[model samples]
Structure formats: C-alpha cells, structure tokens
Target chain A: MPALIEAKNVTKIFGGGLLDKSRTVALKDFSFQIDSDNPSVTSIVGESGSGKTTLARMLLGLAAPTEGEVLYNGKNLEKLGGSDRRQFLRDVQVIFQDPFEVYNPFYRIDHVLETPIKNFKLADTEKGRRDLMIESLEAVGIRPEEILGRFPHELSGGQRQRIMVARALLLRPKLIIADEPVSMVDASLRATILGSLLRLNREFGISLIYITHDLTTAFQVSEDIMVLYRGSLAEAGDVDQVVRHPEHPYTRLLVGSIPLPDPDLPWEGERAIGRPAGELGVQGDEYCQFHDRCPYAMPMCVQTHPPLFHTHPNRVTSCYLYRESPELPMPQMTSIFKSSNREGPPEETEQLDALDAELEVSQENSSTPTSADD
Target chain B: MVEETLSAEEPTAAELKETLKVEDLHVYFHTAAGAVKAVNGVSFSLKSGERFGLVGESGSGKSTIALSLLRLIKPPGKIEGGHVFLNGTDLVTLTEEQMRRKRLDEIALVAQGAMNSLNPVRRIRDQFILAYKDHDIDVKRSGLEERIGDLLTRVGLNREVANMFPHELSGGMKQRVCIALAISLSPSVIIADEPTSALDVVVQWQVMDTLRSVQEDLGASVILIGHDMGLMAQFVDRLGVMYAGKLVEIATVRDMFGDPLHPYGQMLIASLPSLESRKARLEGIPGITPSLLNPPSGCPFHTRCPKVMDHCSSVTPILQEVRPDHWVACHLYEEA
Candidate 1:
C-alpha cells in the first residue's frame, strides 16, 4: 500500500552562499511516513531549533528539501500536477500555532469558513454550504449563532483556535498537521482544544501529526512519538514505551524535565544541565551532536556518530550505549567503543563552566534582534 | 519564621509581622464603556521568605494585582480603593517621588519576556549601573563592576556576561540576566510575572532552578503570577486560584493539589494532563471567563460552578477558612 505522505531522507539547509560561510542545517537526513490504511496520531517533539516545523513545511510542500524528496501517494510532491496536486492539498490540512494571526481582521468569521467551501466546491448551493459550516462548527462545540457574524478579534483565543479546527474539518482531510495548537491557549482551554483534535482521529477517521515542545501533551494524545534533537532523530517508538522508559540521553532529559502537577513529587536529584552555547549544526556532522551536553558521552561518540539501533521491539534509539544490541546493522562500529580504554568521562563541570564563558563571547558578534519587538 | 510560629500554635509579636499584606484591594480601569473591576476586594498576605503563586486564566487580575502592589498602574487604570502594606508601609498613600524611591529598594519587579525589559542598545553592565544610579546607591566606580559580576555569578551566569549586549544572549541566558538584576538590591519582595513562559521546557527547568536558588540566597518573598498550574504546583509553597477578579481559593500547594475545595479550582486541577496517569477524557472547565466590564452578578464563578446553588447568583460567598489553613469562597462551605 502506498503511504498517504512520506519523506525520504529529507534535508533542509538554510543560508550559506559562496560569500557567506555560515549555513544552518535545519533538518538532516530525516525520513518519515504515514500509512494510508491505518489512521494514527504521531507527535514530532523537539525544542526551538529542532527542525520539526521545517519537516512540516516540507510535508505540506510549502518548502522544498535541499536533498531528498517528499512523496504523496508514491509520486514526487514537486512533480504533481493538476488533479493530483489539488487532491494532495485537500487531503492534508494544517492548524498553525497562532490562531489569531491566521484570520483577517477586516472580515467576519464567516469568511474563514466560507472561502474553503467555495474554493473546493464542497457544497452545491448557498443553503448546502451554510449547513456544512454549521455542522463543522457544532462538531467542535461552538454555537453558530454566537460565532457566525462576529469579527475575528471579538472571539476569545480558545474560540478562535476551535474555529481553525472546525475550518480544517470542513475539508475533511485525511491528515491534519497541528503545530503547537494549544501552546498559546490558556491552561483551562487546552484540554478542550486537544480533545477536538483527538476526536478528528477517533470519530472522523483522520490521521494527525502533533508537533510540540511539550512532552506531557504529546504523551496524552499521540500513539507514536519522534524525539528530535538539533535537526536529528534522537528516539522513535511507541509513546507509552518512549515517554515512560526513555532510552536516549536527550529523550530521558526531556522527559525528566517536565514539571509534574503533583506537589508531592517535587523535582529532585536531577542536576541542572547548562544549555550549550553556539550556532546549531556548527559541530561537525560526523560526530554525535549531543555529546557535548550528554552525561554519558563515550570516546567513540566523539569520533563517530551513532545510527538508530533497534533496542527493543518497536523502539529505536541513537546512542552508542545500545551499539552492542543484536539488532544493530552496522557491525563494524560496535567493536570500536569496546577497545577504547575505559576512562571516566571527562570532568563536565569545568567544561560546562568554560562553555558558559565562551557562549557570552561568541554571541557578542551576532546581531540578533532583542526583545524590542515585544 | 512564620512556619515555626504557626507550628507552636501561638503567634509571637516578632513572627506575626508579615512581609507584605494586601487588604480589600480594588483596581478598576475607567474605560468609556464602563468601569472594569480588574481586581475586586482581593485580600492576601505573604509571610517572610514565602513563595506565593497567583494563578488564573487570561484577564483574571493576576497581573493587575502584581502591578497594584508596586503602584505601577497608570491613568485610566486606578487603584480605586486598597492598601498595600510593605513592611508596615502603605504604598498606596506614598507620593510619586517616594514611590519611585521605594521601588527596587524595598520591592522589585522581574517583568515577563526578559528580552523586552532589557534595553537592546545597552550592555548588561550599563543597565545594572543605571538601576543603581536610579536608587542613588553609593558604590565606587571600581567596585561597581565587581558587584555586578558577583550578582551574575549568583544566577549561574559567567561574570563576562556583563560585557555582552542583551541581543547576544539566548532566551534562558537573558532571563538569568534578569534574575541577576532583580536580586541586585536584595529587596524584601520580588514579583516575577511569567518569568519562564517564553522558554522551552529544558531551558525552563534550568531558569526556574536558577530563580529558586537565587531567591533562597536572598531569602526574599516571591509573588509569582502565571497561568501554568503544573509549574505553580511544583514551585510555590501556597497557591491562590483567581477567577474574574476574585481569589476564589487559597491553600497550601499540597492541600490544593490533593483536595481542591472550590469548583473552579477542582476543574482547573482536573484539566491538567498528568504524567502519572492518562485519563480517557479530560474534564475542562465549561464556559468562558466572564468579562470584567460587567461581571456576573454576585459570585464571579457562579455561571460555571458545577455545584452552584440559587443564592450563588444573588449573594457573593466570602472567602473563609473551611479547613485549618484552606480558604474557599463557595456557598457549599458557607454556614446558613
């Protein structure tokens, strides 16, 4: 069976001209797929520079990958023409992080629901279109009377976000890529917004790719999760296994950092890890990207990057500690770490302290905008 | 100190002194439409070196109360009636000049979005120097740099960060710089409004850890205002739940998390996604927050309260001690 959407070794590199020496690898050699037959919710978890958004853009065909290709229905996305392209556009919809920015201030909320119906020709008559709009709005639990004639600013943040979900439902897409949908909403309304998205998969038979920096929400909603670290896949597996028992050092740190809502379980015993300072992707791609901040960095990690090794059933982790597992395909690299003298990992406290000083000096030359825009 | 006094079952004269006390505070914005009571008759007190969290949805007056405490509300928005006692000094009655002098010396503010609060054109050291100059602190030029460096080190940043501009640092580093600046005066009260809301989870933990350490070192009471309940549960000693300009519940963190008394607090706590157990369906609070312009008649949360009675809409419930230390403003706990 052909995949509904697929990314084959996708890579995205931003900036770096003949004159410019600096280039940022937003994503590196990443591959993913969503099956057409099975509807599932997959979460792409990452930090600010983790390239989750870049991957979403490539899947939507908004941006082309520097090296690999995105395939829709087993055909290259860039080469699709006529009906195939329109079908792809209709089959996959998106809900952005900021709900307020997506709507136009000049028009009423009806403009948002009406344009897609007219463009797609989802309804034959005006009455039919109005019925479809009301059905979609009711599906997301918004009363049409209170919402129809109001301007975008008149609605609250939670209401606006629910409207965005309702608009996506009008298209009846097979897959919806929600990028931090509930991050901006208040704590009280987050569960409501997330519940609507979950209903799309359970009741409406739509697949979903939830992209967020929050692991707790991802765990609650997704069946499968992919942890991204600086544009590389750190861990991938079932959400239950990965989040409950994370194997990758980065994944473990990410899961451990979540502040549980129980006061009895205070965050204790975990030493604070200082953030590494420097431009991402500046480190040589041949070495493990996480070795600098990783607590269990071995000598081999500094010499060669580790590939994703199958650690358990339905689980893969990119760490040298699991290199000896039977499922490792690269047999030649496994022996290299075993032969190295087992010395205690270099004292990280002093190195981390030194890096803090270096970070201040290195950032002195970059002219990034400050919080003046806020 | 107050904890020890409470444990003895008797309040001594010295330990009875609260670091900060707010009584019947009312903040209103006089707009063309009407008077929006942003904060109405809210009263709370902070013991010395205690961490108190004020949590609510948007427009719940959490931030307004913070500004009111510091006398930072501008025109159109006025402190209609209130008394903010800081070390027995009523800030509402102080003149403009006196209030200006009192700020950063007795009370300080670590505003949200640290990048916006710091000047882009100035180096980190210059901003610290300007703060010192504003309060007229007498420190020699040669020792000023050392003092700034020491403050930076206390917040887990390198002393060399003082020479770098604000734009050069990352988000976490910038917040640490803000935390360092907040403790420079060693003020008795520090109001940090959503200090880590803009940061990533990993960076948030690091920054909160830094804030916790520096706050402990200074032994200053913190008034943390935010909407994140999980963060509040973990960081604060006592939590206050606000709804439509009113504090509906106040209790120790453990008690509030274990057994929330008010319906609003219960719904808010139940809505949070927990790592320990995943529910099939999360029960969110029904209905939206009422507008402050014309809030609900008597009890602000009566419209959404699950156990609301007939009198809840006509008569307001006063916040009273339902348990030993837990306070709830609900008719369910009120005596006839």
Candidate 2:
C-alpha cells in the first residue's frame, strides 16, 4: 500500500517576482512519507523562520510548491478531482497554532462541532450529529454540556484548543497536522492537550505530524523527529536517539538551548548565542546554511552543502562529519575535499579567531560565574 | 498590615531594607458584569541584585502586579488598597509627576512584545534620545550617542544597530534593543514581563542570556514575569506561584522544585515535559482557573485543589511562613 501522504523533493520559493529582487527559499528539497499501514507520530522541529509552517501548508495542499510535488495516496495533491479531492480533504486534517483566532465570534461553539459532521454527511439526523459531537468531546476529556452552547470567548484557551482536537476527531481523519497546538495554552494545561493527541495516535490509529519549536513536547509525543534549520534538514531519526545524542551541530545547539524543568540541572557552560538575524533564507544551495554559527564548521561546509548522510540505521544527518558513512553517494564532488583540509586557509582561521575574541569580550564584561560548576 | 507577617522570618535590619516590597496589593477592574479582582492581596519582596520570578497561567494577574509596581494601572483598573514600597517610599501614594520620574529612572519595565514597543518611524538612536530627554538627562549629543552605543553593546548588539529602524531588526534584536533601553538609566529594579515569549527557543535563550548579563553588571533586582516553569527554574532565585489572582505559594527555587508546598504548584511542576525522561502521562491539574469576577468564597484554588479540605471553601487561608523560607497559603499547611 502507498503512503498516506508523501512529499517528493518538494521546494517552495516565495517572492521572486519581477519587482521583488529578494527571493526566499521557504522550504528546500524535502521529502518524507507517512505510511498508511503503520500510523506513527513524526515531529518537525525548527525555529520561527525555519520553514516548519511552510512545510505544513504544503502538506495540507494550501500552498503549491515551486518545484516537485506533494502526493496524497500517491496522487498529486494539486491534480485531485471529484471524489479523490473530497476523499483527500476528509482523510487529512489540521489543528492551527492559535485557538483564539480559529473560531467565528458570531456563532456559538456548537456550530464548530456541527459543521464538520454536516458537510461530510457523517450523521443523517440532528440527534446523530449531536451524539457524534458529544462522543468526540468526551474523548478529549471535555464535558459536552459545559462547552456546547458557550461562545469562543467564554472558554479558556485550553478548552478552545481541546474543542479543536474534538472537531478534528469528528471525521476520524487518518492524519492530523497540529502546528504548535499547545504553545498558546497554559503550561499546566499543555500536558492535558498533548495527552489527548497521544490518545488519538494510540487508541485510534491516526498518524500525526507534530510541528513545534518545543523539543520537550515533541520528544514526548513523536516516534520520529526531523530537525530543520533555515529550510534545510539538519537531522532526522528516532526521537530518543536524535534528542539524546544529536549528530548535526544545529541539532546540538537546539538541544542545549532547551531550559530543562529541573532546577538541579541548571544550564551549564557559556552558551554561544547563535548567528545574528537578517541572513535567514538568503543563502543559496552552494554553502551550508549553518556555517556562520556552527562551532564545528569547516571549510568544506562553505565550499558545498552536505546531503543527508545515513549515520546510523535509524538516523540521517546533513553534516559533513557524517559524509564518510557507507550509505552516502560518493560521486563528482570528492575533489573538493582534496583542495582543503580541516584547517583550510589562514584568512578563514583569522575570521574564526575574531569571532572567538568578540565572544570572549562579552563573556568577560558580564563578570557573572560562567559555569554552574564554579 | 502584611508587613507583620514578613517580619516572622526574623531577618536583620540590613536584610529588611529590601529594594522593593509589595503588601496587600488588590487591583480590580470594575467591568459591566461586576468588579473583576485581577490581583487579590498579593505580597512579595525583592532584595537588591536578586532575581525573583512571578509565574502563573494567563489572567492570573502577574502582568497587573507588574503594572501596579510602576503605577501604570489606568482608571477602569484601580489599584485598590495596596502599598508598593520601592526603596522605603510608597509608590501608590505618589503623584503622577513623581511616578513618572520613578519610571525608567528607578524602576523600568520591558514590555511583553518587543515588536510593537519600539517606534516604527524613528531610528533606535532617536528613541533612546527621546527617553533621555524625557528624563531630563544633562548630557551632550555625542555623549548621549556614546551612552546609547554602550547600552546596545551590553545587550550583545552592535553599535550600528542604533542607526537602523525597528523593522530592520529581527525579533531577537528588537528585544535586545528593548533591554538596552530599560537599562539605560541603571534602574534599581527591572520588570521583564515575558520578554522572550514571541521569539523562538534559540533566540529566547540568547535574549535571556543578554538580560541576565546586563542585570548582573548593574546589580539590579529583576521581577521576571512569565508562565514558562522551565525558564523560572533556571533563572530565578525565588519563585512565587500565583493562582486566581492570589499568591498560593512562595519559596526558593530549590525548595519549590524539589518539594512544592501547594497542590497547584506540585501539579504545575509535574505537568512539565522533561528532556531527561519521558512519562506515560502528565498529571495535568483538572478544572479551569476560577473566574476572578465572582471568585470562590474562600480559597481561590479550592475549586481545583485535590487536597482541599471542607473548610477550604468557607475559610480563607492567609499566606504565612510554613517553613523557614517557604511561604504557602493553603488549608493543608494551615492545620499543621
């Protein structure tokens, strides 16, 4: 059987019109597949401008990719017609980031739950539709009587978001793409929302694409994880392996930056503030996107961008350090490594030294204890 | 009147000279429905050069307390029956002109969203200049420019950033600029209300790092208001857990995380997803935060408190010293 949804080397570029000179490559050559036979949770982790949202938009067929194609059930998403389009829409669903803005202020909250059932013809009578709504709401731990007649404003953020989850469950979609569903909710309520989503994946065999900036929640819910940096895949693997021992430098930085809840495990070491802004999505495919900020950056990173090299049986990282992996296709560009060693040129070394000196000065100026060990 | 309870700690005279002290703060908004008690009898103190954290869910009145400190509460929202003593001076009793001088010069606020805080049409330098002029700083144009450059550099931004507009800067850069402006006068206290909420995690860490460094250099007390428990655990020396506009618990960072006194605090800590280990299910605190307009008769959290006693709904618990440094206002501790 074919995958539920698949993207084949998709590339999305925004704003390269005749008048507009700057072209932003929102998403690079990305490919992934969710199998229909085996339902699993895959998390797409990235920063704000890292194109996580753009990928979600493309997968939902809301935006067309500039190059390559997005396929639902092995058919091009853009080309689906009649029954195929309707089936695709029914199977695939989305939960947006902000629950406050999703609802229509004029309508009662019941309208949100009733519309999906009416449009899909899941229930013939009003009573059948009401029963379906009540079941879905109770599945997510929400009392139907308390939430049925209330307006969107009457409910708390957590309640509104849980209702959205119930709305998604009304259709029993095969796949749910939740983009930062709990980011707006309270810290204590986050677990409640995520717990229900995890239930959807387990009790019901639904695949999930959990897109968020938070690694902790992603690790809790996702089986597989993909780390994106500036529209490029940094690392992808089993959630445990990738989070515990990150291969790519970008992934390492992201893992290090997470403020763990345990006060005993305070953040140690002088965390290098990663690169300045304004250079996002501007670099071409010629050079690695993370070269400027990467601590393990070498001349090879500047010379050519690295492809996803299989590091382990379950892991793939787009870093030159893993280029020696047996699964990597060694072809035309082997000559580039011969031109430069790890220590490339005197000028490049000097530039790195200058950056080091700047960091040192800022560290010294602070005069606080640099590490927790002290 | 709450000052008497603070004396129960039995500190030295030197220790009593706190940089900022709030006692019996009750701020309410008289809306059409009724009087919405946003902040009810909340009290805390900040020592010089200390980092104190105020954490709660949205509408728990953490931001309202911050605004009350600066006397920024407007007409509809009244700071009803409270005394905000900043350096031995009660700020609530001060005139508008006196409060204006205290703001940015003595106590500064780094607002929630940095995107809208800065002036869109003006350069960063011009904004800094305007602040200096409003405060009536006697300095030459070149000296002001040099001071602005120094402030920007302290927050890890280049001096060239002063020449650019707010739109040209990224979210992190805008936050850094806001930090720079807040610390321009070397205020004794800085209230950063969710300064990094809009930025990504990486940028959030970076911006927080900058804020910490600048704060250390100035030896200023910081009232960090945010709902992220992980951030509070790492950054703050003391933590205050607010519920339904009241401070349900207050303790040192180590004590609060290791052993939270209140039921709500414990649930909050348990609910946080950890990188160290993954649990089968997180124990989220059941029941919604109570509506402050018509709050619960006695204990604000009794509606959701798992360990609540019969008297919890009929009798209010006063915040008192349960341990040496730990303070809690719950019936469970009251019996002890």
Task: Compute the lDDT of residue B66 as modeled in candidate 1.
Answer: 91
Candidate 1 local lDDT, B232-307, one digit each (tens): 8889988889898888898999999999999999878877887765443444566677778777787898876768
| Interface RMSD, model 2, angstroms | 18.8
* Candidate 1: TM-score, chain B only: 0.94
TM agreement with the true structure for every prediction? 0.90, 0.90
Clashing pairs in 2: none
DockQ (model 1, Cα): 0.26
Error of 2 at B112 (Å): 0.8
Tens digit of per-residue lDDT, candidate 2, span B79-156: 887688899899999999999999999999999999999999999998898888889986565687789999998998
lDDT of 1 at A356: 35
Q: Which tens-of-lDDT digit does each residue in A1-374 have in candidate 1?
A: 67898888888999985356678888888888876666677889999999999999999999999989999999999999999999998999999999879999999999999999999999999899999999998777677877898788778787889899999999999999999999998887787777778777766878899999999989877767889999988888777788989999998888888888888776642344533644233344576778778878766776667887888766778899899765444222111221111233211233223323322332232122111101
TM-score of chain B of each: 0.94, 0.95
